[model samples]
Target: MLLAKVIGSVVSTQKSPSLTGKKLLLIQWVNADGSLPAQDQIRTEIAVDSVGAGEGEIVLVTCGSSARRVFPEPNDAIDMAVVGIVDSVSQNLSA
Candidate 1:
């Protein structure tokens, strides 16, 4: 899983059969704590919206096989998905 910020959305009139009625979103990778001014990751990417995430919100992103399972069928062509809308992130690490 990864933390990402919702940049915007993608709208398409014509798309694949499985993608019909799905909301495609644009997101930019963020730090685990959801702080912006990202560390070398300004580029935006796309993801299928599972939760009702909106622009400028911090979200939880799942990718690859895990992303495929976010749906009911689990066999769709979804490579990435926005699973949760993050409220806060807290952690303590010792090394």
Candidate 2:
């Protein structure tokens, strides 16, 4: 799983049959501090959301083998999905 922030949304009128109702989104990978890296510093990616995540929301994204767990019937084409919305995050440096 990776941490990402929803930067924007995707509107598609035409798509593959397997993606008929899935919501597409523009997500930007964030650093541990929850800040988006510079364009030259990191690659941005998109994910399909079945769970209604909006822009500016911090989200948890599952990919590859683990991504399938988000949806029981995830087709072969579904590579990513937004699994959860994070309300607050805190890191412990003393651990």
Best prediction by lDDT = 1
Clashing pairs in 1: none
Task: Compute the lDDT for candidate 2.
Answer: 0.80
Model 1 per-residue lDDT tens digits across residues 1-95:
88999989999888766677888999998877666655575768899999999999999999998997888773477899999999887787672
Can you tell me which runs of candidate 1 are displaced by over 4 Å? Answer: 37-40, 93-95
Worst 10 residues of 1 by lDDT: 34-43
Which of the numbered candidates is closest to the native, going by highest TM-score?
1
Give the Å error, residue 51, model 2: 2.3
RMSD of 1: 2.2
C-alpha TM-score for every candidate: 0.83, 0.82
